[model samples]
Target: MDYQFKLLRQSRQNLLRFTEQFTLEELNEVPEGFNNNIIWHMGHILVTQQLLCYKNAGVPCRISDEIINQFRKGTKPEALVPEEEVTFIRKRLTQTPSLLEEDFRNGLFGEYNEISTSFGNTISNIEEAVVFNNIHEGMHFGYLLALRRALTKTV
Candidate 1:
């Protein structure tokens, strides 16, 4: 579990670095042929983690319902995310994992409901959800890389 948390932290750090290079416009730009943008991916990562780990466990999620509505699966960016909200998301990208670790250590997730992911995997426990989340985040990280490359080419 410690190793999983470590990987998650490192992955998010890489994401933060990937996002820091883009201006707000670039972060918000949905390049042709792409359904979403870099910041949307980042926000989705945050929202998905909360849903998978806390919400599925029958625990209250840390993020707002509005955030869940905006960034959850099947949702595209409806408007340009302000730099302020981006900043909040960036902070949570790091903070949420630490809080998750603490909550896990304290045994806050004793009742995870089995949930089927869009990727066809069924997560049956909090531990499995956390591990799956790392994979999910990595997938989005790849999307972020591809989006950045596309955005850069158009610049």
Candidate 2:
């Protein structure tokens, strides 16, 4: 479990570095052929972590309902995100994994509810959720790399 948490932290660190390479405007711009912006991906990453871990386990999410509603599965960016909200998302992006690790160590998610995802996988426990979350985050990171290339018109 410690190794799982360590992987999550390293993944987030890499994501944070990738995000820092772009300007806020670049992060907010939706590439001509794309459905969302880089910032939207950031929000989605943050939202899905909470949904898969805390919300699925019947624990309250540390983030707001507004954030969850805006970036949850099946939602896309509807308008330009304010910088404050983007900052909040980035903040939580780095912070949530450690909090989850702490809570898990304390046995906070004893009754994790199993959920069958839209992608056809079920996460039945905290361990599975964490593993799935790492994969999900990596998918978004790859998409972010694609978004950056599109936005910059670079190979």
Candidate 3:
């Protein structure tokens, strides 16, 4: 479980670094043939982590309902994410994992409601949910990379 958290943190840091190279417009731009932009992918990963780890455990999520509604599964970029919102997401990307680690150590997640992911994975507990979230985040990281390439190519 510690290893899983470490990977999550590393992946998020890498994502932040990757995204930091882009301007606000580039991050918000939906490349041709893509359904969402880099910033959307970033927000989606954050929201998805909360849903999988906190929501599934019957614990309240840290993010607002508006963020969850906007970035949840199957949702796409509806508008340009402003700089302030992007900053909030970036801060959360670094902060949430530490909070989750502390909560896990304190046995915050005692029971979890099983949920099936779109990828056909079943997460029946917090441990599994955390592991699956790493996979989910990796998928979005790939999408962000592809989106970055496309956007840069068009420049």
RMSD to true structure for each model, in Å = 0.7, 1.5, 0.7
lDDT of each: 0.95, 0.89, 0.92
Judging by TM-score, tell me the better candidate of 2 and 3. 3
Output the better candidate (1/3) by lDDT: 1
lDDT of 2 at 120: 83
Tens-place lDDT per residue, model 1, 1-155, is: 99999999999998998788999999999999999999999999999999999999999999999999999999999999999999999999989999999999999999879988889999999999999999999999999989989998999
* Candidate with the greatest lDDT versus the true structure: 1
Ranking by TM-score: 1, 3, 2
Please estimate how well model 1 matches the true structure, expressed as its whole-model Cα lDDT.
0.95
The 10-residue segment with the lowest total lDDT in model 2: 146-155
What is the alpha-carbon lDDT for the whole of candidate 2? 0.89
lDDT per residue for candidate 2 within 38-128, as digits (tens), equals 8888889889999899999999998999999998878888988877877888899999989999999999897888999776899999889
Q: Write the per-residue lDDT of candidate 3 for residues 1-155, one digit (tens) a residue.
A: 98999999999999999889999999898888998888889999999999999999999999999999999988998888999999999999989999999989999999999988889878999999999999999998889878878987999
For lDDT, candidate 1 versus 2, the one ahead is 1
The TM-score between candidate 2 and the true structure equals 0.95
